[model samples]
Target: MMDPHDDVELSDLEDDAFIPSTSRAKSLKGKSPNRFLRWLPPRMRAFLENMSRIRLVIITVIVFILLLVFISYWNGRLKDVSIPKQSLALSKELARNLSNTAIPEYVLTYAPLVFLDSEDEFYPSDMAAHVSNAHPTMNFNPVKDAPEGLTLDNLNDLNDLGGDSIYLTSTTLLTNLPNYLHGQKPDKKTLQTENAVSCVIALANKEDGILDAFYIYFYTFNDGPRALGHQVGNHLGDWEHNMIRFKNGEPQAIWYSQHEYGAAFTYDAVNKIGKRPIGFSAKGSHANYAVSGAHDLHELDDEIPAHIVFDQTSQGPLWDPTLSAYYYTYSSTNNKFEPANDKTPVNYLYFEGQWGDQEYLDGVEGQEEFHGFHKWTSGPQGPIFKHLDRKDVCLPRDGGCIIKESL
Candidate 1:
């Protein structure tokens, strides 16, 4: 006979064998910002405070601000890069027969001069080593009757005219123009043409005999080790420098350092090659002469330091009193030009000499001397270097060179 108890046991075993393995779903546990601290011992809370959300928020804000600043800097630089082509095109389009009257008379008159501070007593021993150095070929004896009322301090009066883009509108002649042709960035390279920007020249509305006007020009170019002049002339102790502006309106000449040049750098070859001996400034040195000898000043040629460019920004070109003393301005108009107007000279020279390269006194040999320049090596000269290397008047800006108020 079959035992009922044995059957029951057999049934229990069968049931156990039939049961299928199933996995139960587990609910997820997300951490709450506050819930996390509850489980920690009170002692750990102090250390945990260091990692609080508030600290994280602070760090995030700081990082965000830094990012914004960096973005602004690059944005301005990139915008500047596009400026040259547009600026040059604008000037070229407006300028008819560029060689003639279109160049403005003041540019020919009172040609800006760039001179070495013959007064500079200090120079690197190595830089002092090689070839004899060059200096300005002109004199910079400030204008005597310069409106008697005009001063570099009144620049802000024009800020209301055009938010920093009105300075280039004047048609009157300028005796001196800045030599910001070669700047650190692509924008600077075209500075003389369009890349260079001039804001409105503001004046306090002259009433009596005194004039209260200011001019500002900003040369937005790159500065420091890796720039063109610095890279090529590093062995020569050259550096990348530039000119910033605060040009003014008021239609007239500002100042003049006598209308003459010297012979310190006016070598024989300079005169023999061309009648109008135009000179160009070194990218970094802003030296008055065109030749970029040897000796890199910043060792910028080998490599641009990784830390050279950090988060920085430019608020357009204007006179920051904090950065103004080192700057200067130039202005011009067409009526000032005389027929034999070597008086109003333009500092720019085309590589091939087509753009007024041959402009001179009709038949005068002195005119043939073309102001003592060689077309192949033409460099613009200006007045900013009047006190070159002077601890006082020189540009406080980092650019080793600042174009003198040239043509």
Candidate 2:
């Protein structure tokens, strides 16, 4: 989760929080008939002389008090739904369940489809985590203990295919987690920020009480800090024993990312393939996943991203485009690369200076020439971007992919 409120972390940001001139309770305390007249400006005080009768003034003060209570009551409930508290038993139970059940479609729906360098489709959260760092601890460095059953994956053979095992993201559970646990809600601030301006300060009379009871108020926009969200959520990926279960209900391979595998004290972002995913477009950005993991997703020569940071961290994705083998090329003839020459990140057929010339790619499905001018002669994505930003986009919630009977 990237920080959605305002890009960048609190430490890096300049303080711009809305601070009231005076506390609401203090300002509204014990108003007397003469008090109003004395405190108000001269012209206003003169006009209020008649209305300052004891009973009228007392009623006005009471009405103001009631409004505050109402605001606090309603706002408190919203906070409960967003950030819920995690139970040790529940976290362990969930980790074990993940090791057995075939993650449901509802769960799959929660994965985040990130914008690749190629501007293509997406991957699940767990898978994204694997690609990002190949470890869950990269996500949970703060936690000191591990839950049961999550210790290892016994379902599949995870000997790297001469490379590394791919961990999948699990926004699916995030999307559907609250359903399994009742009485849990989002953190308090999460809800207040959404409606704070419209709400009155009097509602804060019980602000301390609301904070204590409310669980979901920690507001969540699409982009928020993974650390904050993961902390309260008991992100299972970081546990030492976190295991991968197969579709048929058996623990597969033990899963962890490069960070967890390396065992370092400080987190290394450069080696980390995971981060708050940046999409090519969203509602405020663009409404689409550009293409699948490819080389041309970003503007050419963009060494570092220059967009807003949710927590103001210098960021990168689970994958890097600079290491890929493709370039965003265009010719007067729009030559679309299909079945994406996945062998390498890009293909030379489109760049050999022969694509636009009707020699070979003249009648390609994606290449239509208008007066022999090139429009978009690169990879075109499928009808729908497979992943959304919020879910499986960053980690592999589905766990490892495989099956085996229990010994």
Candidate 3:
């Protein structure tokens, strides 16, 4: 036995026996990196493998936060789409009619100025003249406000205590004021005056010739509402217009200006006398309303707008050309229309400058270079007088526009 054991070395004798080694078993049980984590750092890979649930929760939370931020930003830029029922119905009809109506159709072969001479074209002139004369008698002496003897003949002399100009012209205020005592507030007897600014002579093309496409212009001195203390955009002047589009001696569409944008309705949808459509201007903003409660899309204070309903019992100041002075020029040769006759109150068509002072801060978010109820940069431009097919005739900017496609 001793001889046989000696022939086999001590290491051979140990391998033949069954040996238990803890270190060797542990090394064989250790895990290797899977294909997904092969590129990661060794320590990071080990951490991720141990804390997979924690990492997944953190990623989900980060993604949710990013989604919330995106939603908030999206809603901040969204515009209001609330339109009244009658307005909506009229808008739909306009879309339907526009589909059948071909653009650039010359419908008016003759001048449409003849329509203005008839009673059907506008409201009664005597009534408008009565409204112009109806105002509260001067109560407060404005000598301190207007040191220049308060002639009040010019709009420039009507600055308030804060130096902000006002447009509330009364019979006693603007009529070469015998005294300087126009009050600040309006009473039950006081009636606001609406002025007829200008008119547009548009033509639409037809198979035979051209047709009547008249756009009548009206304006108010106080654009902002009395509420907000006239804080938003209490400018001195605001211009609102209504467009009557005609085809083959028949009224086709009526466009009303409401702030920066407006709506077009089929002629049948509107209340009209022959070819002229009725328009109601709100009290402060002087925005055109097709029907009662018909308001602008962006009006924050809807109630502030003149609740002027245009009907038999309730009527807005229908633009009476006889009571209000006007100036216009149209050249068929050049196909150009412009404000003319310097005798009119505002010879500003050629001014190409702002009407009011720029007193507000610059670079403000919405206040920058924008008209508001308080401060205004410039008076509105005259209505566009070119054919609808012309490149320059755009919506709201031209006071009216034609729909070439579905709105």
lDDT of each: 0.26, 0.23, 0.38
Off by over 4 Å in 1: 1-40, 46-50, 80-385, 388-407
Reference-based TM-score, model 3: 0.39
Give each model a TM-score: 0.22, 0.16, 0.39
| lDDT ranking from best candidate downward | 3, 1, 2
Candidate with more favorable, higher TM-score: 2 or 3? 3
Candidates 1 and 3 compared by TM-score, better number: 3
**Model 2 whole-model lDDT (C-alpha atoms):** 0.23
Candidate 2 structure, TM-score to reference:
0.16
Which one wins on TM-score? 3
- Model 1 reaches what TM-score against the true structure? 0.22
Which portions of model 2 miss their true places by more than 4 Å? 1-48, 51-58, 78-124, 127-407
Across residues 1-407, which tens digit of lDDT does each residue of candidate 1 receive? Answer: 86756536767677668753343112223333357786887778657877686899999999999999887556433121132354445444433433453233222221221212222211211111111121111111122222223222222232333222212111111112122222222123233312212221222222233232222222221121233222211111122122111123212222211112211221222311111222323233333332212223223222423333121122222111111111122222221112212332222100111100112223533222222221121122212222222231233335553333323
